[model samples]
Target chain A: MSKPVSKFYLGVDIGSLTTKVVMVDEESRIIARATGRTGFSGREVASRLAASLLIELQLSEKDVAATVATGYGRVTFPADREMSEITCQARGIYQLFNKAETVIDIGGQDSKVIKVLPGGKVSDFTMNDKCAAGTGRFLEVMAGALEVDVKELGGLAEEASDSCSISSICTVFAESEVISHIAAGRTKPDIVAGVCNSVAARVAALTARTGLAPDVVFTGGVARNKGVVNALAAQLGTRLLIPDEPEITAALGAALFARDIAPKNKPCV
Target chain B: MAEQRRYRPLASTRQLEKTMTRYYALTRYHRLWGRPLRRPLAWVTSGAPVELLLAFNIHPVYPENYGAICGTRKVSAKLCKVAEAAGYSQDLCSYARSHIGSIMRPDLAPMGGLPRPDLLVACNNICGTVLKWYEALARIFNVPLLVLDTPYLPGEVTGHAVGYVHEQLKEMAADLEKITGRRFDARGLEKRLLLSKETISLWREIREFCRAEPSPLNAPDLFIHMAPIVVLRGTKQSLKYYRQLRDEVKHRVDQGLGAVENEKIRLVWDNIAIWYRLFAFFKDFSQRGACFVTDTYSGGWAVELSPGDPLESLASTYTEIFLNRSLEFRARQMIDLIKDFNAHGFVMHSNRSCKPYSLVQEVIRRQVMRETGVPGLMVEADMADSRVFANEPVKNRVQAFIETLEA
Candidate 1:
C-alpha cells in the first residue's frame, strides 16, 4: 500500500530585489522555505524555487493544495490567488503577535505603514513608493558610495561616536551629500549612522500620517538592519517586535491564506 | 498569457468628438467670424458667471478647459517648464502654469494656443489661485480684468455674502458693457439665466441616471461630457448636446448595461482627475469589475439654480460651490453621494495642483468612512503633471483596497 500523502500550501513572493517561497502544512506550520535573487525574471526564479522545495520534501506537484502569490511582482507569478503585500504582511504579523496594532514594512523599493485592526485585517495603510529615499535601495546606494557592504552598515553605525545629518530626502541628492561628507574627511561610520537616522525620520513621518499604535511590528528586508531598526524605534518612541526571518513574513502570510482561506479544488500552477 | 481586458467605448463618443472639434474650431477661427458677428472674446474661469458675459454679446473662452486639453495631449509638462522658466513658481496651480506657458509660447501650444481675449474675467469662488492666475493673464494680454469677489461660505450662505456678490455683479455688468461696447439688457440676462438653468437641470438628470443598478455612466463619462455644460452654458447648443447624451445614457440604463463590464463594486471619486492617465487608470479598476459611478469634481455643475431673482440666484448658486464650502459640508456632500449612488467605497485623489480641494481631504476621508462604514483610499498625484504619478504604488493600494472590499 502507498504511504498516505500529506497536503501542503505553497506561497511565492516576488519582490523587486528577491523572491521568497514558503510551504505550510494543513495546520499552518512552516514545512520548508527557499529564497533567491529576483533578477529580471521573477517568474522563472519563483517557479524554479517552488519546484525545488517540492522535490526536497519528497512530494509531487499534486501534493500542493493551493498556491498564492504576493508582492510587487505578484501578478507575474501564476498562482491560484494573488494578494497585495499589505494584506499579506498584516495577516502574517497578526498570526505571530496577536497584539500587534501597527506594522511598518520597509521593502526594497517602497516603504509602508499598515494599521492592523482586530481580526487580522488592514484598517488603513500609507506607502512611500513614489521615490526610493527611505527604502532599502536608498541604503544600498549610500553603502556603495562609502565603499562598504550593506551588511556591515548596522555594526559600523553602532561603533560610531557621533552621527552626521543628511538633509536631503532624495536618493540622488543624498548620494552627493554623502560624497561631499567623504571629501570633507567625515568617517564612514558616522555617515552610515546618519543615513540610517534619515531613513528612520522619513519613515516616522509616514507612520504619523497613519496614526501609529502600540505593539508595532517591523518586517521586510530593511528590518534586518539593526541600525535602522534602532533608529526607527527611537524616532517613533516605541519598541518594535522583529519577527524571525523578517523577509519571509509576507510569503508565509500568503501560505497561511492558502491554508485557511483558499477553497479545496482551487486550480493553481 | 493572461487574457487582456477591454472597455466598451460609449456610443456618444463620436458625437462628443465632433461637437468639441467644431467648438474649438469656432473658438480658434473666431477672428474670421467673431468680428463680423461683433462678439468680443473674453477669457473666463470655470466658475465665472459666463451667462452674464453671453448676455453682453461676448464670446466666452475657458483657459482651464484648454489646460485640460494640454494635459490630455501630454504637453503640460513642457508648457509648465516654459512658465517656470519665466519666473512663475513651480508650486503654482499647474493649470495656471500650463496656460501661462502656452501664452508665452503659442508655437508649442495645442492648436496654436487659445485665441487672444479682449477681456479677462475671474471669480474667487473656486479658489484664490484664479485671482492671481487671471492677474498674470491680464498683464500678459494687456486687457481689462473683471474680478468677482464671492466670499467663501464657511457654513450656510449668509445674506451679507449674497449682498457682496450682488454688488460685484452690478459693477461687473458695467465693466462688461464698456469692454464689449454693448448694453447689459436685463431681459437678455434673464433669457441666458433660463438657458443656463435648463442645461444644468439636464446635467443633473444625466448624473442621476447613474443611480440605477449597474450604472449607465462612469466618472470619465461625466468628466468628458461636462465640457459643453462648462463652456457653452447659456447657449442652445449646450442644451442640445446634453439632450442627446441624456437619452443615450437612459437607454444604457434601460438595457442594464454597466459602464464597467461585469460590474461588481461601485465607487465614488473625489478631487480632480489625473488627466494624463485618465483612461488607463480607470481601466485598472474596470478590469477588476469596479466602476467609479460618480465623482464630486464633475458634479460641481449639477447644482440647481436657486429660486430668486436671476442675479441673486447666480450669487447663491455660484458662491455655495462644493469647493467653496466648509469641510463639514463637503463631508456631508460625499456621504450623500455615496448613499445616493449605492457605492461600496470611495477614492480620493490627493491632487498636488489644487490646494483648497486637496487639503483637509484626510480629515474628510476619515469622517466619510466613519459615517458610511465603507473604506476610502487616497492616492497622491498631480492632476495635470504626470511626473508625480507613481504607478506601482497606486496600483498596489488600489488592488489592496479592492481586496479588502472583496473579503
Candidate 2:
C-alpha cells in the first residue's frame, strides 16, 4: 500500500448522519474507503477520516492530487471542489452498475429519486419535501417508539407474516400511529413491516414522479435495511439493485469527480 | 467565489429607482393630493382591469406589488407572522398574508404600509386567493369589494367567456362610476388602452433583446423593472419607463454585453421570482455563467392588448393571463420561452404560496422537457416566504442541474 504514488484523488461525503471518505488512484479505481459518524462537526470528522485513511496508506497530504466534497455539510469541508450529492450518487451508482438508469436514495434527512444518464450524469431527479417521513430519520423515530433498535427493525419486518398499515406521512404523526398499533396489541414485527412499507410507499411515489426506468438502483444509509428494500421493490414492481456499500456511493462519486479534475491540476509535489 | 465575474449592472436601474419611488411617493401622499383633487384610491389585484379604473380617474394601488416590496426588504417574515398570529393559515398566499399583516401593524411595514383605500378591486384571473384576500381588505378598510370572476379557461378564450367577462367589465365601469363619482369615459379608456399597448410592446421588445447571444438582462433586471408595468400600466409614466429601459437594454445588446458575465447558460425561469433572495439566488447561477435570460412571471404583464374594443381588449387580456391558462398552454408557453430565448434549460419555482402557478409545474416541466429536448429543474421554495425554503437542498438541485447541462 505504501507505493509512494505521485497522485491520489479523495472524495468526501459529509452527510447529515455520517461522513464517508474514499481514496482513488490515478486509474479512477477506489484504493481505500472510510466511514464514521459526522457528529456535531462534519468538517472535523471528514478531515479526521480522510487524514487517517491517508496515514494508513502511508501517504501524506502532498500525494493527494485533488479532492471533492459532497452532501449537506459539503461546503464546510476543505476540498478542491464541492458538488451536489445527486450527481455524486448517480455517478457512484453508474460506476457500480452501468445498467442503472434510475436511482432511489433515502438519506437521513431527505429522500430522492434520480434518473441517471450514461457516465453517471443526472438526467433528472426529485427529492422529498421538507419532511422526514420518507427518510432514515423516520425509521429511527419509529424504531424508538417500538422500543426496538433501528438496525434490528429490518430483521423484525423480514420475519413478519402480516403487516399493519401506517397511513400518516408526518414523522411525528406516523410515530404516534406506530404507538397506537403497539397499544392495540399489533405484533412488533408486523408494525415494523408497516413502517417499512410506509417509507417504501413514500419513495415509490417520488420514483414515479421522476418516471422510473428499468435497472433501478437503491442507495443511501437506509438501503442497508433489507425490509425497506423488499417493500420498495414490491411497491415498484421491479427488481432493485443494491450496491455492496450503499452509504459510500456518494463519496465514491465525489472521488470520480475528483478524478475528473485531477489530471489538469496535478500537484508539483 | 472565484475571480469575481458577475452580472453587468444596467444604468437604467437608477432611473428605474427614481421612477418607482416617485410612484410610491405619489401613492403614499395620495391621501393629501387625491382627497383634495377628488381622485379616489382603489386597492387592486395585479390582474384587475386597470385601464377601466384609469378611465374613472381612480388611483390604483397593488397589494401584490407591495407584498413584493415587503419580500424584497426581507420584512415579509415579520409581516407574515402578524397575519399568522391573527389566524391566517401558512398555506395562504404569502403576499396576501404579508399585505394583511402590514395593515395590522403598519409600524413594522415598509413605508408604513399602503394608504387606506376607498374601494377594493379583485380579479380571479391570476388566482382564487385574490378574491378572499380582497374580501379581507374590504372588511378591514370598510370599503366596497368589486370582483371580476374570470371563469377558468380550460381551452382558448371563448366567445361566451369573453362576453361574460366583457359584461363584468362594463358592470365594473358602472361600479367605478359610483365609487369615483366620474361618468364612464370611453375616450379615456381608449387612450389608456393605446398607452398600455405601446408600453407592453416596449416591454416585449426589451425581453426580445435577450434573444441575443449573451442576454443583456437577467431575471432580476426584469423583476425590478416590471413594477411600473404592473401597477402603473395604461399610464404615460409606465410607457416612458419602458422606453428608457428598452433603450438601455438595447444598448447592451448593441455593445455585446451580458447580464451574467460570459453567459454560458441562458435559462428561462418559470413562476414568480424568489423576491427575498432574488439577487442572491440568481447570483448563484450568475457566478457560474448561467443567466436567466427571461421568465414567465415578468412576461405575464407583457401580453399584447387585443386590437378591438377597449372593454373587450381589457376582458380578453386580463382573463387570458398565463396563470389562467391550461397546463398544455402553459407548457407551450414554457417551450416557446426556452426556444425563443435560446435557453439551455428552464427552472420552475415550486412556489408554496402561488398554487395556480406552481401546482402543475411538474407536469409542465416534463412536457416542456420532452418537447424541447432540454433539461428542466423544479426548485421548491415560496416566492415570498423564506420559512418554506431549504437552502442546502435547493443548492443541491440547482448545482446538479447546471452540472447536467454542462455534461
Candidate 3:
C-alpha cells in the first residue's frame, strides 16, 4: 500500500475580475480560502493571495502536494498543475455537490456554462467573454447609473415589488435604458431587479442552448448576489444549489484536482 | 426643389437613359471618380501594376494585394512549381506563395501586372502574419520597406492612444510624400477622408438594415458584402458600390425577407473571416439558417463624425475601433453586438493567423457569457491565410457547437 501524503494542496483561480485561492489537505477538506480583487498584476495578486493563505493555515509550500491554477488567467499563475477552468470546475462541483449536472460560473469579467457529465467531466460548455453586459462590470455600470454601490445593488434588487424592464442588452445602452426607465417613473428597486433579471436572462439564454441538467450549482462572484441567483434559478426553472462559498468553486476545484494528481506522486496500491 | 428638379430625368429617352445610366453607374462606381489630385505615378522595377497608380499623384503599391493578384490571375501556379523545387510548401498563405512565385519569374511580369513598387509600407496592426509576409516581398523586390509597429492596445482607446495613432498617420503621410516627391495636400486628403466616410456610412446603413427582425443577410455572405472595402477602400467606386448594396438591402428589408431564406439561429460573428476556407466556413452556417446578424466589421464601421471635423473624426474613428483597442474594448464591442443584433449567441473565430484578435477569445468568450449570459463558441481557424486552417478540426468543433446551441 502507498503511504498517505501529509501534504496540503493549493488551487488558484486567477480571473480577470477576481483572483481566488483555496487550500485543502490530502482528503479534499477545505483548509483555507482567499478571495481578492485582481487588478493589473494577476500573477502578483494570485501569488500573494496563495502565500498569505499558506501562512494563515501555518503550512509551508513544501507541504503542498500539488498546485493547480484555473480560470481566465489560469496559465498566468506559476502553478505546478495548470488545468483549464473546465476541468477544475467540473472536479470542484462534483466534489461539492455530486448531483450537479450543469455548472454555471459568472465571473467578474466573463461567464461560463459547463455541462457536467456523470463522473465530474465536462461534457460540453459555452462561454461568453466578448461583452461586459452580463459581467460584474455591467453591474457596476448599472449601479453607478442608479447612483448606488454595486454591493448594494443586490439588496436593492430584492426590495422592489414592481420591477422596470431594461431592453437594451448592450451595457452602454442598458445604462441609458436604466436611466430612461428611472425617468419614466420606475422605482430604483424595480430597475435594479430588472437589471438582475436581464443579466440572469442573458445567462439563462446561453445556458438554455447547452441543455441544462437540473441540480445546477451556481458559482462565481456574481452568484453571491441573491437577486441574481434567484433570478437565474427562476429563469432556468431549477432550484440553484449555492455552495457555502460559491466564489471559491474554481479554486476548490483546482485544489481537488491537485489532490487527484497528488495520489499520482505516491506509489500505486 | 430646384436641386431636385435639376437632377430629374429629362423628356428625351436619351436623356432618361443617360440619367438612369449615370444614376446606376454612380450608384455602382461613382466613388472612383472623385480624384482629389492628379498624382504622378512611379514605376516598380518588378511587380504587378498598382490599381490607383495612374489615378493618384502618389505611387500606389501593395505587395500582398499584388501577390493575391498573381494567384487569382493564375501565374502563381507556375511560380509555385519553382518554389516547390526549392522546398516551399504549397499550403502556405496564398499571398506568400504567389509573391514567392512572382520572384521565380523576375524577368516576366506574369503576362499582365503592375510595375515593381518604389516603396512598401507594412502594418502589423491587422495581423502579425503580414510582417514576415512583406519581408519576403521586400527581399524579392529590393524596395524601401517601412514597417509600422502598432503596439497591441489591450483594453480601451484613451486620448493618448488617439494622439499616438494620429502621429503615426502623419508619419505615414510624410513617408508617402517623400517617396512620391510631392507636397502633402490637406484639401486632397480631406476629399479622400470624405469619400472614405461616405463609403463607411453606406456600409453602416447596409449593416444597420440587418438589425431588422429578419436580418437581410447571413454573416458568411458579409464576405461578399465587404468586397468594396478591400478592393476599393478610399475610392469612389467603393462608395458607389456600397450605396447600391445599401439600396438593395433597404429594398429587401422593406419587402420583409430574411437575409437568408430560413435563418435558424441569429449569431454574432467575432474575429475576421477565415479567408482560405471562406466559402466553406460560411456555407456551414448558411446551410443551417444560422444568420450572422452582425459582425465586428460593421462595428468597426460604426464611426460617426461631429459636424465640421470629418478628418479628425476619421483619424479618431480608425484608432478607436475595437480592432485598435484593448481586449476589454473588444469584449465590450462583442457584448454590444450580441445585444444590438439580438444575437442568440456568438461564434468567435480563434483565428490562428491573427493572434492579436484570437488570443483573448477564450477569455472574452467566458466573460461575455458570464456577464451577458450569452452563449459563445470559439472556432479555431485562420484569417485570410489558408495554411493554418485545420478544416476538419474547425468543422467538427463548429458542428458540435452548433448542435449544442440548437440543443
Candidate 4:
C-alpha cells in the first residue's frame, strides 16, 4: 500500500487587538491554531507564530505550499495571498455550518455581524468600529470589575437567578454601573449575566437592523462565553451555532481560500 | 418679491460683524435647535422632489441651513434636547442632533411647516453617517432615494473620473427629467453655469476681502452667507445676492472694520465647520478677538476650471475634496490654508462622527504646526450629533487655547 500524499497550508489573521494563526492539511482539517496579543511589531509576531506552529507540528516550512493572510493587518503580513477578513470570515462560517444564514463575529476590540446568502455571498453586514462598547474588551473590563477570571465568568453568569439591567451604552459608564450594582448588593452571577446581556443587546440591535436570519453562528473570541451566547440566541429568537473553536474561523477560511488559489497541490483536492 | 424681501442682504460689514458677535455671545455652545422630524415630517422630507420642494415657493429647509439659523439665532440647545431624550449619547455629532431636533419639533418652524424637502439626497461623499440618517428617514417616510456612488476616486481626479462623474451627472439629470417631466435643456444648463460662475466670482471676492488686516466679516456672518451658495446654487438670484454681499464686505474692508467687535489675533479653522456648534465655535474664537481668517471650506472654491469645463471641474472637485483625497493631499491643503491666512494658530475639531475627515487630523495637525509655526489644537466633538457636545470642557479648552495663542 502506498502512503497518501501530505501537504500543509498556513493562514494568518492580524487583527487590531490579536494576531491569530492557523494551519490546515489538504482536506481543510485544522492541524494547529495559535493566538497572541498584537504587539507593536505585527510582522515579527506573524513570523514567530509561523515558526512556533511549524515546530510544534513537526512540519518543515517547505511542506507549506501556500500561505494566506486576512484581517485589518492582512496586507501588513508577509504572505503569498492577502484577503479581507470579511471574505475570509464569511467563507469560514459557510464551510463549518453550511446552513448558517448569519455570522456574528465579536473580536477583542470590535464587533461585526455578516449576513450570508444561500450561495455563500455576503448579502449585508454591520460593523461597530466607532465605539468599544459592544466588544470583547467590554467583557474583559466587566470581568475585572467583578473580580472574576474572564474564562470562568461565562459559567458563573449562566448560574445567575436575576440579572441586573445595565442602562449605560458607553463602556466607561457601563463599568461604573456594574460597580454600583455590586455596591447595591447584586449577586456576582447576576451582574456577570447583566454584562453579558448588555453586550448581547447592543449586538442584537446592530444585527436586527440588517434583519437576522436563522442557523446563526457566533464566531470570534466573545462567542466562547455561554452567557453571551444564551442572551444573543434569546434576543435573536434562534439557536446560536458555535464551532468548537470559534476564533480560528477567519484563519481557517484564509487557508481554505489559499488552497482554492493554489490548485496544483492536489493533496487537499 | 415678498419672499425676496425676507432675504434681505447683510447691509454692512459692521452690521454683519455686530450681529455675528451678538449671536455668538448669546448662543453659548453648540446644541440641538429643533425637534426630530416625526413620521409626517419624514413624509414631507422624503416625499417630493427636493428641487421642486425648494421651489415650493416656501423657504427650503436644510438641517445644515437650520444649523446656520440656530447659530445666527443663538439658540441651539433647545433643539439638541430632542436628540438627548432619545438616548443619543453626547459623543454623537451635534449637527445630527440639531437636524433630529428640527424633525421632532413641529413648533420650531412657525412659517407653516419649514419648507420641507419633497425629496432628500444623502450621499456618502462627506460622511457615511448621512447614508444611515437618510435610511432612517426612508423607513419613516417611505420616500424614493437616489444614491450617487462616487467611489473613493483612488488618486487625484483624472480624465477617467471626470468621465465617470459626468456620466453620473447625466444619469441624474435624466432621472430629474423623468420625475419633473421636463427635459434638461442645454441652454438652461449654460445659463445656470454662467450664473453659478458669476456667483462664485463674487463669493471669491468676499473671501479675498478677509485678507485685510482686520477682516470685514466674522465667521458667524460668513456662516449666514453660506445659505445662498448651498440653497440657491446655479441661479441668477444667487449671483446677484453674492455681488451685494461682496460689495458690503469690500466696503467694510475699505473702512478698516475688524471681523470681531475688537481687533485681536487671527486664527485658522481646520476641519469642516461644526454646523450645530457654529455659533459657539465662532463666539469662542471671536470673543477673544481671534478672527477665523481662513478655513478649509473656503479653499474648495479656488478649483474653478471654467464654465464650459464645469462638468469636468465639478467632477474633479468631488474627487479631489479633502474628505475624499489621500492623507497627503489633506496635509498639504492644511499647510496651504495656514500659510495663505498667515494665521497665528489653528483649531482642529477632532470630530468623532466623521472618520473620513477626522482619521488623519492628528497627523496633519502635528506636521503643519511643526512646519508653519502655527500651533494646532484638536477640540473633540460631533459635527451633527448634539449628544457629544460637552460645553464645559469645550469652553475651558477654548479659554486655555486663546491664552496659548496670545502667548
| Better model by DockQ: candidate 1 vs candidate 3 | 1
Pick by DockQ: which candidate is best? Answer: 2
Q: Which lDDT tens digits does candidate 3 get at residues B1-407?
A: 33211111112224323433443343233225423443432322111111222223544444444554454344555655556666666545545555565666654434334444555656555556667766766786677666655555665555676666557656666766666656766666667666766876888887888889778766655654564454345667667666666777788789887766666788998876665465567667666667788888545544554233433444455544455567777778888888888888888887644566677777777778777775677775545444445554355446545644554
Give lDDT: candidate 2, residue A23: 94
**For model 2, what is the error of residue B13's alpha carbon versus the real structure, in angstroms, after optimal superposition?**
1.1
In model 3, where do residues sit more than 4 Å from their true spots? Answer: A1-269, B1-56, B59-115, B128-132, B147-151, B154-156, B298-315, B384-387
Q: Mind sharing the TM-score for model 4?
A: 0.52
In terms of lDDT, model 1 sits at 0.89
Please give the TM-score that candidate 2 achieves against the real structure. Answer: 0.98
Candidate 3, A1-269: lDDT as tens digits: 22334678899988777899999886789989898888898889999998898778766676777888877676678888676666677789999899899999887766778888676776567665357777778888898998998888879889989878888889999999998998998889999999999999889987965778887989888888878988999888888988889888888988987887775565322
lDDT of 2 by residue, B338-367 (tens): 888889999999999999999999999889
lDDT of 1 by residue, A1-269 (tens): 21235568898899989899999887788889999989999999999999999888877787788889999889999898999988888888888889999999988898999888887798888888488989999999999999999889999889878899999999999999999999999998899999999999999999987888989999988898988999999999999999988889899989988887656655533
Cand. 3 Cα-lDDT? 0.68
DockQ of candidate 2 (2 decimals): 0.77
Give per-residue CA lDDT, model 1, range B209-312, as digits (tens): 99998988878888888888988989988888899998898899999978878889999999988888989888878888888999999999998887788788
What are the runs in model 4 whose C-alpha is more than 4 Å off?
Answer: A1-269, B1-61, B70-97, B108-113, B274-284, B298-313, B383-387
Model 3, B86: alpha-carbon shift in Å? 6.9
After superposition of all CA atoms, the RMSD between model 1 and the true structure is 2.8
Cα lDDT over the full model 2 = 0.91
Tens-place lDDT per residue, model 4, A75-186, is 6787887766766787788888989889999987668777776745564455663577889989989999988988887899889999999989899999999999999999
TM-score of each: 0.93, 0.98, 0.51, 0.52
| lDDT, model 2, position B349 | 92
